[model samples]
Target: MAEPRVSGDVKAAFALLITLAALTSLLGVGALGWVVAPICIVLGIYCVLRAPLRSTMLTLMFFALTLENPSEMPAAGQWQSPFYMVGALLLTHFKTVIGGPWFFGGMDLMLAAAGVHWFVKLRGRSRGIPTPKPMIKLAHLCYATIAFTFVIGKLNGGGDSSMAVWQIDRVMYLPAVFLLCQAAFTQPKDYMSVGKVILVAATIRALISMYVRAIVPATVDPISGESDLPYTTTHHDSMLFGAAVVLIVALIIQRTGPKALRLAVLLLPILFGGMVANDRRMVWVQIILVFAALYLITEPNAFKRKLQRFALFMVPVGVAYVAVGWNQKGGAFKPVQIIRSAVDSDSDESTAWRDLENFNLIYTIRTKPLVGIGYGHGFWEVWPLPQVDYILERFIPHNSILGIWCYGGYVGFTGLTLLWVAGVYFGVRAYHHCKEPYDKAAALVSFGTILIYYVQCFGDLGLGTFTGVFLIAPSLAIACKLAVKSGAWPSALRPRQTA
Candidate 1:
């Protein structure tokens, strides 16, 4: 497929520029940084100046994965913790002066300081920080869709003002981070560095999960006398562990860099153990889908062919195991139990509720049908909803992809779908274009992460959350950037175009 460069990317660049400026200035980004957020700004500048690639490995966000987002009210997800962490240092939300309209927090300071560096370092470049053209356009489309939808919402008196704004803000994080990532990461080494950081952070998160699991006692159902492990981590950790497993496996498969197999062997077991300990059924589904997608994207080779034959041979045995183990009481068939819990809603209360919730979202779409009920509006429930402990049900759904279709209607859904599919498409193209083993491994990892992201979106509220945006946006950037480097796609550079 020909990856054509489009006109008006300059406009997109200008839009990003505007976003950065607006965030910094209008948000009072660092009005009181001297007292509270100095570390974040200093850290951002340090990363950019000292070693943009290496220094950013894990400073700002590793701690974020472990904590919840309480700095802001009605915490969206753990990913939101970064934005609130600065104020959270005092364990309090900054009043209107510091974190209010005139003040920004740690995350705000970091982004502002980093944006300044990005603009200065990549100054006067036409490649415009190496972003994909279509993504730039889609970012604009997303913002425009929000405007259109909000007008419809306001006219109809559709939803709560605050919830609507919160949803819209989360929606923008995807494209905004997409732009930031494209501009910030400048080379293959940057991707490799960031990937290593992700592995380390996620590995640590897994360890904490294991610790939590060990301490938390299982809750026995009063009626059935069945014990269930309390969820130790958020659903988003599944993405973290799943991506790590895939990346390490690819490294082992390709032997991409020095001591790659040794490194993979060291980390793979821990990540897998973490997944089992976390006890998320979706992890298995995501890993299976990501591995399958990775296989499809990669060029056929002797090892892959052998693996295919082995899989084919195991198909019958795998089926029989599932068939027999579906109802087995033995703990030896736990993997089957997990898989069964995913597909057979009767096996788990979580899955059963999701199924019922999905019906409500589907019914909502059926009624709205066209422009959606618009943003801020709650999905109309056709049936009584089972009470969930989660309070954000009206705004964010477990099946966020379905929620997008339910809330944004056809136009919004199409825009997001294009971005999602295009990410994998470009990732595959990058994989084929890269010649070096390391580059190939990087592309493969990025590709698998994006696929895992898809699973997260469907199985949980992954699409609009900060975790999903940050993960996918950066992975998407790596793929798009690598594709440009490998001459599979055009860069935004104005002068001597050489890949």
Candidate 2:
């Protein structure tokens, strides 16, 4: 007689059920507890099974949801809920990483996980894990400065709300994420996997955007004649999708996978349509700059052929855009018409407000050139409109470089600038060093992503916001890791090989 075997999946399911039963018995007394008990237990089991990868995936999912439904997600603090789940998981499985039992949890769990992983790796310094390079060291310093700046702001009665301070602190996770990549990623495929995950997330985001736009069509304001929906939010979503599109196109050119290329090509029009519908002038500028940079960086012959194919592919997209515009009265999808609409300073209040904002930020930076005003605090003395109550609530400069200068001071701004420079340097180095076509393409796309973000910083909030950090940080980390693995870094700084 054969004994029945319990598979790993069955064992996992049983363990989950037992855990849920125990949790329900102990804490599920009320109706609310009964509901929470099962959910918590399931998340606990999931964390135990996958640990940090699960954490990363959840983080990405949160971003995707936010992009898809920003208006809905923040209504009941729903946007921050995923972070709570991730925090709980990390705390429950603290033994898996170096850290243990953290109380203050949120997206900060990502930081804690990275910190613990780095601490454990420190014990194995002889095992070929290199010392932190100047760029990485500076990144750590920037993270510390961000924390110190927030504390100083709070102590000085600068910061308004506890939540605001927490929001600022979440950006600090960027440095920790970068450090985690150095430890976690050891090969080109690992880096490629990161890109694939991001692209898939973006694809989901695009679908969601299409769904939302379809369900809730933009309404026209009778007085202003502008669309009632928030264009900036849509533009930001489009930017994320645009970055994903660029990465995919670059990978396809690098010949990473024929199937991926085919799929990406199929989705190109959908993604581009979302961008056009968003109608952000700066986003369009960014798309152009990104493609231009990609063209310049890739091999000439390969780029030329790719461009010819792309031009032919875009003919249909051009016709579709024209048709979409034709459906609307007085709307034409000519390039000139779109560009003129974007730069219509007379009609565009947003652009006018941005100009004024930048002037005020620059004036404030002149006063405190060293460190600017601390976090959560804005310079209202120089505000153009002191009468408006909401004007006083303007904490960020709405421009990443200016925001850095205002919040972190000159030192912080310089540190951030150097971080971008380091990113580009590493990306280029990785591209040059990698032998395989696909690896080179990945490196090139990574470089383009950072470069595009840098260009985007001039007009929009760049690294200061979660969205900007989410888009750029992981790619930068992967680029740096790839550079290190390819021995593009100087020999003295290279990780030593252990017996």
Candidate 3:
């Protein structure tokens, strides 16, 4: 969708940022960034205090689009990201004492501010503010799971207590952010703004992806290099790539004009460039699944009928193409190659590793089916695999669904299952009950995003990462908010009736 008008506040924020960036260039960034850093922090603090919700969203966007997760820390051939500095500000504990602080640093403060404002506004009986009861219940479920798992782990002597805490925190990050987003929003339409911002952010991220692709060698080894080489970016980016595609498609439909065309023309190439350049096969699979999901959720129409007709003819051709390209090495078979590399362990070492890891996780669950090995312990290895540099290999598994089942046993698995099931239920209800097209379209976007995120967590280690939480939390919040607005969800608390 074409973005709304550029407001004065947005202009001001950009101008202020541009001025700060200018200082970095004029005084030599490397040597003098120290001087500018504190100034920026002070300014940031002021901005957050003045406008917590907007600032919170922007920070999330930065996390989603700018920073890389620890899994893929120094992206090859690209300039270094200011990861540790920014990550510390977001993730480190900010203490006023020598000992550990009571607070959770900047992120906690931001949420606290936003939560307080939400309470004040709701107390005054503000119209259009959503009360997501389902989301609130789901948050409790998530926290309870963590608490239960942590205690079980400690009692069982699973492993490092601190590491156990960190492991559970990462998993709980989604529900925590989901609550914050639910509180921060005042109206259903607010979701559209979040969607637009993420789309734009993904586009910018795609540009960076293109740059990384250009400078690096496409493959590390001559034979099997395509599969042997690491993914073009982080594993989580497969989610982002799929997100950009579905969001653009869902937003642009049912609209016409130069604006629509221009939006598609301008953003699609950059977004797709990042997607293609990134060279992760899962993105392609996720994209197809998301589109199918969106189609199934939406009401049937002429466009869909046409698509069915198109598919009837193309299905055989697609089958034939796959038959021929399954073993071919030509560029025409690139999509087929990606599919093969993803599923066949022989073609890609990464896939083989995940398969072995899956067996290990399954064994871990079978051994401790009730309380689980808890969060602190590593997955029990029936088929031990070589250790990688990743420190949380034991804690975080590629198949997060199975990982949860193993870590938390039946109880934690129930929590995760209910959370996502509730999210999907709300998304579908919102889409069907929407009174307006914008509402419907937004519901679709949120639904598709949540689905893509689930695919990531199922296939990759997305459940325990910042990127996945940032991507999924906002979308889940939006879905519930829309469902409530559309009356598909009953009011959590009835408003005061005025005479």
Candidate 4:
């Protein structure tokens, strides 16, 4: 028999194992510092080289584990494994290292090297099919907008330069966007598989956040300004509150199974913990939107059936909320105050509204309707009033859209509107083609979450955080995947859809 060839990927895996093992022995894991630090470094690298979907799944699991127990890994070395120790310190401060600069930077390095290697391997062969035209166009538009902002800033000379850097970082949205482009050219089923990875990662992140927010104890630093943790407290409140919204939408859309209830039960502590954190405003707002949207999305018959089922489901939750109303210092769902706080024109809750000394966003819109300021600039700078200065007090704008307007001016504002409209249009089309119930449900979860984020942006910088990045990236990837699967992207280009 002829000798069989070992695949390139298998060879790569073998090489990775050998490298890790050698590093372990050389570093000497007999000491506590040596044991886990190298292990984590190897795992982090492993996550980058694996399939994007698989790597994300592992990343989520790691995040959950770390959040649940900050001290789960052995302490990093005082000297030897400095990279690992530095990563640990960063993780401790930010509460997420997997999605932070280290992970991305490492991946970028590996990808650049691998891409060159692959190019050499295919030196005489044709290049892999280029990404789809439409997807490429969208990516180009995004990239162009980012470049345009920087150029405009330079041309103007001494405009908010920091805002230019922030807009450039917005290019981080590109990786996930390119992933969607890949999805457009690949099999549709792989999209769901990829989506499942994202959801699982989110679930893992949520579970870990539950522990952090509910059970973990942490301290706030007065001087350097950071969370000091003997790991005493976690930022559970938002995680739980957000989880609740994710849960209800998941159930309604039927994405998660019985696990939804189980997760909800597990998440109770997080919900309570979030309330204690005093970040109740967004949580309460999210909850109301979840229920309201749920009510709107269902048909008459299903709505009636769901109403009965919901009542049953609400029994325990309602009772708990009622009983623990004040006692659950860690809970959300303050009906009256939530609405009042969110809409209160004079309070910090209404940052832009109060800052501008205006009661309505509509009024502010009338003042600078076309371009607005730019991404971080908002109306406050152009006007430069005492109240605006007092409210933000040397801070960025709370409203994401307003910030775009302030920084980018009319041109950037137009680009933003188009970007969001494109997102919604394609996202809805993706929702329509989803065949599986769970897939549909997950799509709905994304839909509702995006809606909440978009609405929240009017009052807060909702889409500005890494949380927003996680939410939008997966949603867009899933959308592109769905479109490709439905034969909407072109049969020759589309791969078969799978669950």
Candidate 5:
């Protein structure tokens, strides 16, 4: 042996331990526990030896544990997040059956190890380059705004606990977004990697949605607990719609670009699979708007050329649609009932009520006007009974503006609104000015996709969830990059001149 090559030794050790653990576990308890314990010990050792693999393994373990027993995973719905709540409290308060007490001690150790690794990497790479001062300032500003709102809510009283809750929810998103922004700023290639990751994640999510729609009966099981599981008319549709929009832009860019068509081609089936899952509004709108943005932003001559080619391609698609007309009843292309119900929405009472609720929320935001009622405070609570009727269960105000009103109040709201205005200004300018066609296409598609979220938020609180926050951050970072590339902002903080 070559004096125990580090990589080879680690790989061999990992494989051997994993194999022994699996085999021993299959035989059952006593030996199984012993075998697995050694493997975990080895894993801890190798994790330090192989940082990337360790991080990946840790993430995988987290997801696996969550999916296997979602109910048990740290959550406010029942038991709190394992580390922060139970571990920090109960485990610390009393001795345990296994090991030295302290509930969250192991978690703290893992987190500390991860933090050390992260700082080491950061220090190693930040050789002579200046720290990202402007980005850091913006990050601090966002953090301050959140802290200020929280402090204010605390000072105000317990009467507005709901508002405080909403504000607290938004604070969770900053870290994830900041991490993504850091990745984009330091390694733009990472953004593209994230794009591919989204495609992979979306594919799995689409498949899950398809299974849920086609296999799982809609019947509610009383024994399983709860009266009814919430049904989403456009549940599986978001990923499909977003992917389709991306695909269309990808196809259009391919017309004149020196770029790979593989991503778009690869993603098409995933989009179709999503479409088959039956939710449509968000997806369909995303597709339309992305192309529309592309058309709007490109130079007139280039756009005309692209449009002509698109029209030529669509002729064949149109001809096929006409030829097949309603003949494929049970085929993959069959009409979806969800689509029909969605389109024929004028008379639906549920649709009317949902829309009305959304409208009322918007109107209430107008009442508080500036600063609104304080971050996460009023709007939704006042929503079901705007006239102070019995408080219905507080909900996520479907609209983003309403959410801002409920959570951020005036000061936080002002900061966010300025960000939006700046985002739009830069986004349009970036699309028009970027030198690389693929980069331009990516920017425009991202801008349009994000814009769709703006529209979708008019009747949904899509941004409140952590998943939604992750989705939004990348789009914002891309927009920011595009803005910088386009020179929409002056080299200084001053506004750009209009010719």
Candidate 6:
């Protein structure tokens, strides 16, 4: 067959995009001058010429941005600050895609790209822009509502300005990533490629955590307290690492690649060891829940066999943990010590504090009920005034669901619950609709990962950070797209061009 001709309209639009990029670069030259201008021009040209490479480049950038640690790389911060890492990575990627020095950052550019793509695709179609599926629409609505409520609360002097901005990003910008990803992941192969990127990123993180714990133990030490082995950053980064572990195992169970499987098995000790060293009870629970969910979702009939296989897998892992713990000053690896910490409800300071926080949340909810004191207001009510600064700075919430209830009231709480319900529904539908075993397995794995994070959100802010949103949103988008493509849902909601 002859190569399909590029459309005239597409060529024209691309030309316009390039011109705008050039203008932006020219404007920046006045401010940034000679050195930055030439590099931007070259990168912009490369991006236009290598348009197909955009996805892979963005994936790699995502990995680098996630792995960046400002505390550890203060020197690098002078050149590129951690706060702007995501923005910088995104701007560079967008500069290539749009063919100029686009200043928009993070998910904004992606969302705008998706919108433009949709509009272009709709140009000659009878149907207008197709409404997204109900669940997807509801998710967008929830994020928008929460964002609006947060801003209003902030205007009312309910929370600190910086924290309000962070919360707005978490609620709105992060979930918007799903729409951007949906625009790119149009084919099964594309979805698989994204999965591979995630696996590679996770594996790198696992390896780095192992190396850090060994070489710079103090660097990995628990921010909450000292530990023998360096622990992964708690709440945020640790949960992210745990999510990666879950994804890796899910992909392996799906049998993504025999070679990759062998490598992953080799790295399992390091991955699991990092999880153990992280010393977060919630992460440990997340790991267990993910495995159990994966088994039940993917192989419901072979429970006994799966249990045997898992037990065999644990043997080497347990042995490695013991071996590592043997040399440490404290028996951080000792089963007894770990178990004591997990179960010590009355004595463990963290546990006691969480219990108190939970009580305070409950009390506040009962008092305010419908529209609880806005987003950050609960912190002041729940904790002492002196500790409010520390608590607000960390954005720590013992129970995320309750925290939402405290922040946006029942309306926000219900919206979030429905979103998860919709996620689980679509995830199951994806599995049912997929004809290929691998696709089915991928669907299950993605769903299971989201489920793990959803469950974690009940007790921790696992689903409230950029890392958590990035991991879950793309997977959710993949599953939903599969569901639409496989005819599990009506095609009415899928963009006509996408269908």
Best by TM-score: 3
Tell me the spans in candidate 3 whose CA falls farther than 4 Å from its real position: 1-42, 52-55, 68-71, 81-127, 217-219, 222-232, 254-258, 496-499
> TM-score per candidate, in order?
0.81, 0.73, 0.85, 0.61, 0.63, 0.70
Local distance difference test, candidate 5: 0.47
**Which lDDT tens digits does candidate 3 get at residues 1-499?**
2222435564576468547745554444454555664565555444544554544565655655555443354344244444434443444443321124444644555555556655654344444546566678888888888888888787887578766866776686677677767665556578767767777768767887787767665545667464333545666777776777777777666442356567778888998898887776778888888888877778888899999999999999999998899888849898888888778887668889999999899888998888787878778778878878767787877788888888889887887668777888888998899868677777787788788878887787767566667777777888888888888887744666779
**Global lDDT of model 2:** 0.59
Candidate 3's TM-score: 0.85
RMSD of each: 8.3, 7.8, 4.5, 8.9, 9.3, 7.6
lDDT of 2 by residue, 1-499 (tens): 1212335663565467446544543442346443654464455344423444323433443443243232222212312222333223322232222234443432344455445644654334433324237656868776777776676567657577644453365356566556555544444466566666666666655665555555655667898777765442344554576677777787677777787678677777777766655555666777778887777766668659977799899999877775576434443545644454445544357666776777788887787778666776775547664244343235644566676777667766775567777888888888888888777877887787787677566766554444556666766776776677677876635445769
lDDT by residue (267-346, candidate 6, tens digit) is: 66776775654555666666777777666666554655877789899999887775675434444555644444455556
Show the lowest summed lDDT stretch of 10 residues, model 3: 91-100
Q: In model 5, state the lDDT of residue 65.
A: 18
The sequence of per-residue lDDT tens digits that candidate 1 reaches over residues 1-499 is 1212223543344345334433443344455433434443443445444434223323433434444435323212312222333334322323443454533344544555555655676555544236667766876677788887777677767578767875676576666667667766765567776677678877876776676667666677899655565455666778878877887887776767667777777887778778877777788999998888778777788999999899999999999988999998648798888887788889877788888889999998887777787777877777778887766786788888888888878876876667667777778888898888878878888888888888888887776554555577778888888887787776543356589
A best-first ranking of the candidates according to their TM-score comes to 3, 1, 2, 6, 5, 4
Candidate 2 minimal-lDDT segment of 10 residues: 71-80
Which candidate leads in lDDT? 3
In order, the Cα lDDT scores of the candidates are 0.67, 0.59, 0.70, 0.46, 0.47, 0.56
For model 6 the TM-score comes to 0.70
Show the lowest summed lDDT stretch of 10 residues, model 1: 72-81
The runs of at least 3 residues in candidate 5 whose Cα sits more than 4 Å from the true structure, single-residue gaps closed, are 1-135, 151-157, 160-163, 183-185, 218-244, 254-266, 278-280, 302-346, 380-395, 417-429, 479-499
* TM-score-superior candidate, 3 or 4: 3
The TM-score between candidate 5 and the true structure equals: 0.63
